[model samples]
Target chain A: MIERTATIASTVGLHARPASIFAEAAGAIDAEVTIARAGDPVDEAVDADSMLALMSLGVEHGEVVVLRTGDDTAGEALDALVTILETNHDA
Target chain B: MHSFVGVGVFRGRVIGPVRHMPPALAEPPVGERLEGSTAPETAAAALKSAGATVKELLQERASRAEGAGKEVLEATALMATDPMLIKAAIKLVNTGTSAERAIWEAGEAVADTLKGLGGYMAERSHDVLDVRSRIVAVLRGVPAPEIPDFAEPFILVAEDLAPADTATLDPSKVIALVTAGGGPQSHTAIIARNLGLPAVVAAAGVTGIADGTQVFVDGATGVVSTDPGAAEHAAVAEWQEKASLLSVFDGSGRLADGTLIPLLANVGGAKDAQEAAAANAQGVGLLRTEFCFLGNSTEPGHADQVAAYKGVFDAFPGKKVVVRTLDAGADKPLPFLTDATEPNPALGVRGYRTDLTTPGVLARQLAAIADAAASSSAEVWVMAPMVSTAAEAADFAALCTAAGLRVPGVMVEVPSAALTARHILDHVEFASLGTNDLTQYAMAADRQLGPLAALNDPWQPAVLALVQATVEGAVSQVKHSASLETTSPKPVGVCGEAAADPALAVVLAGLGVSTLSMTQRALPAVAAVLRTVTLPQARALADRAVAAASAAEARELVRAGLPALAELGL
Candidate 1:
């Protein structure tokens, strides 16, 4: 598996619209993606496609989080998800 | 009809069946485990199907929704179909837990986990609970515990409503709001004001009233009548007819004899200005400039203040825009402007006094207002709040002159300012009575404290006497006034919550207030009531008010003279 980390850019953190948008994007990708707080162990990661799991991560704005994908060709998917996390939806 | 009296925050009357927000569902009992007739697989299938059904229902609603509420429904729909939910339920069912118990336990586990995460996640716990309740209700063939899906409008009676509860409500469906407990500034009242629903708060025993009980709610009088007698039915019909007219403002503010009193709006920012413009406010009477300095750690730059003011100015081109300078300190303390704490902020360094410690702040804002005025078509008139002495008014007027703004004024919130209005108006152009502060200061009551709300009323004899003094003083200086473009000494106007009252508006007009600036919703009603009485009658009403022994007595006295008020249920 491969991974990437990016800071959440939404003013209210990865909440409401930002979280929903991120989760929907992760679900559309053909990989089994997982996310966790940057300092937490990879074993503690949750499904990136699940809104509940994404929210339960408590990823606040400007806080860094880790994104990982098990699929080989999905290395690009993690990068794109990182882009969503970095873009400020509120702005 | 039995009448329950409370504080009315909005205007109008409506009769509708009250809808109680559903009580929370009972916890599903820890019934027997999946055995015999109810197989574990069958239990698991039931939970999954319930989830699918709920998800489909929410998905359909979400598809038609918009904005933050739409996002809420969409997120909830995703939670309903969450695979983790069913997997956990199936695991519990396999462990011999009953289907109902498994679903409840699985939902609780997820909700508890979300709550534990806190912050944004904690709030999402509600979404889980919402979905959980929906799934359970679907399985049990019962309605979900939430706001109803009634076909017609209603009077939403509740003990109180949370922000979440109100978000799902369709404004059109709620004819009025009756709450058992809340103040004028409560969340329920704010929502009612935003929805333009006539509302009564602090209403006792309203929640006990059953659903589908037809009730008469007169928002102006704060009377919620359960019995719809023949006379009450006629009153409702009259209210509907007059209220329909009150909803459409002609943009002209005058008495029956055509004495003009420019009705204006009190706005905080550009958004409010846009709404006021749409509501056809004569112009902005009080442009509160606190939005900038309140949020910033330091004073906002001249350019930023200019840009902010320009948005409001753009909305009311070629109209009178009375802009009050930044009213910092007091209840609204800015770190850069005033001390962080005070023994008595109500009496401490506030309003125009904030400029004493930080001299350049007011100067910077005045220059910015002039800068913005230069670029826009609005007739920008600047005023300073809390001017206690004639020297302060003169000082403020000089500052306005230096900034190149033509019209300068001082708010008569301070009793001293109202008492010395003639001396102040000699230097300044006009005086606008901020009756909220005027009443609070005159009565020595903290306006924020709920218990002291009675003394803070504008109808207080002492408060009316002060308003009378301010107007008389301004009138005495009418012709000799340096700012006199017209001979009309209606120069002393009102721009407070008191000015919004229809009964009080007539009194202010009678007392010779030139303009009445209030919330836009009050404009049509005030105009409607003002049209009922000629200038001489309004003057007679003001006389009755001033002669009354107490505030309640004063209100009743003035309300009696204007039978049109009772006719329109003002």
Candidate 2:
């Protein structure tokens, strides 16, 4: 599995607009992807493509969150999603 | 006709059949097992099918949605297609639970988890409930909970409405709104005014009125009548026709004697500015500056504040725009700005007083307004709220001058400021009376207290006396002072609910208020009434109103003088 950890950088965190954008990006990829707070258990991680679950995580700015993908070549997808998480959408 | 009373949200009259929103759906039975051995497998398939139906519906809605609605609907659609939610429901079904019960249980679990996270996530908890209801409705073979389709415009009757319900409502389809419970500042009233729909809120027993029963709703006087007679119906039709004609009058607000009153609108932010301008408001009378700071954890940056101020200023090119500085406190407490847990927040440090202690907060705002004004053709005038003393007024005017603001004014909301307005106006260029607060202070009533609402009448003799004192003070200043502008008596405008009342508006104008600013929906009625009365007749109405012993008496006295208000059923 390909996995990465990134701190949320958006002023409003991954909520409303940012969550939708992240979920839409994850949905476009051809691999299973999940996200959760860094220390959460594997089962607690939610489908990254589900905007509702991503928003329900309540990942605030400066909090470390993790993303995982089943495909080995999904490194590019993970990087793109991480960039969005680390950008301040409010600005 | 049997009648009930509420607080009128906006001035207009309409006759339509009552339409009650359907009550909330009953809870689906929990933990019920299916009939046979194939029940578990059958339940899982049904659950999947129901979820898909919900998914398809939400996806369709999302496709047509725009802005925030689009984001919310798309997120909801995602929820319907969520594999984890489906799996959870299936697990429940594996234990012989019914499909509807399993889906309900699964939806609640996720909703509770999100709510447990608190803050913004907790807000989305309601969205989970919305999704659950849609899926359950599909499983139960019933129509999803939504506004019923109707061929004709109808008066909407409801206990209360969620923000989403209001977002989906077509204003044209809603002839008027009547709610059993809500206040002037409630979402229903605010939305009704924003959409230019007449509304009456807090009407007791309004929910008891049967759907499809013909009724007359007078949003001006807050009267809801059932089985209106022919004459009452004709009166409503006449009022509606006159209102339409009044709305089309593009000419500026003036008295019968050709004395210009300059009707303006009280706007919260730029979003409302365009609406006010379209309503034919001469300019913005009160541009509240709190919108820029409300949601921010910290102070908004200079550029952000500048952009917000510029949006409003640009909307009123070549017109007088009076902007009030950040006036948050009490009912609108800001954590970054003040303590949210004050005992008596109304009397606590607020408005310009908070700006004094915070120092740079007001300075940054003034700088932003100055920056916005530099590029706009609008005649921008800046004002401070809740200023009680002359020294504070002088300090604020000095700050405005430092920031390059041409016009500096103070809101005479406090009685002390109104009584000592001559001294306050000596330093400030103008004074605008926020009659809501002034009435509250003058009558010793809390503005937000429902029971004390009666005491917070602007027509109260004491309140009018205070307004009279302020106007007379400003007149005295303009007449005596050599440094001040002598063209007009340092323009004093009424920018509050009082200005919305046609009779009280005339009294305010008669009391020497040079301008009247109110919610845009109320401008036409006030303007229409103003066109019927000469300046002298207005002054006489003011005199009769002020000479009365009580608010009710004062209102009656003034109402007697303005026979034109009878046509509008004021």
Candidate 3:
């Protein structure tokens, strides 16, 4: 499994527009991906492709989250997801 | 013809076939378990398909909408297609819950979660619940609750329309508005007046009138008469001719004897100022400065205030622009300036009184107003609201002088100011009668309460008495300063909603009020009515108004006194 850490850049946090943009991008990729607050328990991770799941995590502005993928082909997909999380959709 | 009576708002007359607002959705039945309902798998499939269909529908609408509206529809569409919702619903269904109940429970759960977040996130709960209703309606084959859609113009009848319900209301397609519920200050009444449509509110039985039923709505008399015959048709034609006569203002206000009453506009900000200037208002009488203070956690700096005030002053060059200082607290509480938990804000620190608790705020605002006035050619007059005592008026006038703002004024909103008007006017150059607040203070009625709207009217004898007192006091101030024959009577202007009423404007003129400022749209009607009567005739009407026992009686007496008003269809 490959893991990456990306900080939320959206001023309003990982919810609303930013979360929707990130989740849509994640869902389009061909891999199993999950995300959670960086310091939280690994088992608490939720599917990254679900907009509601990403929002329910309540990850706020400038907070860091860990993205993990079990699929070998998901490296590039994880990078794309990280780019979305770090880009401020509000801007 | 059958007739129903309610309070009239605005003096418009229209006749059209009625169209009732669509019925709201009923709460769906829910239970712990599905007894003979569809199986879990079948229910899950149905839920999925319904969600997809709703999402598709919303997306299609979003494509046609623009700006914030399109964003809202798109966000709501996302809520419909949320996979987490289906997952939660299936989890509920696996525990023997019916599909409908499961969906509702899941939607509620998410909405509750959003609400708990508070502020911006909390507002999204409404969208989630809306999506839940659409999905449930799709499953049940029932049409979603929405605003009625029709091609031809029709009079809209409703049971108190909420903002959400009127999102799809096409204003152009609506001839007038009739509601079974709501007062003169209610949303329905206010929107109707703003749209310049005939509106009658608080008419209890008007909603029961069937769709496509022809009805005559007389907004002046608050009458909704059904099955109009020849007389009503003739009245409508007469009204149309009179309405045309109540035409565009010629930028001047005069009595039949040719006494000029400077007709000014009450503007909120720059946009309103520009519109008022275009409408040919003599000038702005009440430039509410709340736009600078409202929404700010801390006090706005001098530069921010200057920039904002400059936008308005720039609109009316060489015209009178009366700017009021930050009138915060009471109905308009500012976070940085007011106590949120005050027992009775209306009676407590409000308007000028806010400065007692937070000093330097009003001073800073005056400085800003002075700065904006310096660069603009507009004749800027500054005023303080809620000034009661001569001492309070003196302090405000001194502050204005200190800030280099000439022509200082005080608003006669409190009863003490009206009762002791001569003393208050001694301290300021001008006094403006704020009839809305004066009525509220005199009648001891909350202006916002629907049941108290009758008592809160300016036509109330007590309120009219206060107006006369203020105007008389201003004239008395002039007589007291007789040593300087060049000095004019301290002008007492009626800068309130009452001034918008054409009949009341004439009565105000009769009472010796020097200026009349109101909503720009009402300027022409008021100007039209004022030109029909001489100053002496207006004084006779004013005397009759002051002697009436109640608001309704006084309004009737005044309307009757102005026979030309009926000709103007007011």
TM, every model: 0.65, 0.76, 0.78
C-alpha positional error of residue B528 in candidate 2 after TM-score superposition, expressed in Å: 3.5
Residue lDDT tens for model 2, B222-271: 99999988877887888867777667536489999999999999998987
lDDT score, candidate 1:
0.83
Interface RMSD of 3: 4.0
Q: Name the candidate, 1 or 3, with the larger TM-score value.
A: 3
Estimate the TM-score for candidate 3: 0.78
lDDT of 2 by residue, A58-88 (tens): 8888999999988999899899998988888
Q: Top lDDT: which candidate number?
A: 3
Each prediction's RMSD to truth: 7.7, 5.4, 5.2
Candidate 2 local distance difference test against the native? 0.84
The docking category that best describes candidate 3 is acceptable
TM-score between model 1 and native: 0.65
Interface RMSD of each: 5.2, 3.1, 4.0
CA-RMSD of model 1: 7.7
lDDT (Cα, tens digit) per residue for candidate 3, span B530-549: 99999999999999999999
Task: Please give the C-alpha DockQ score of model 2.
Answer: 0.44
Q: Which ten residues in a row have the lowest lDDT in candidate 3 chain B?
A: B115-124
What DockQ results do all the predictions give, each relative to the true complex? 0.39, 0.44, 0.28
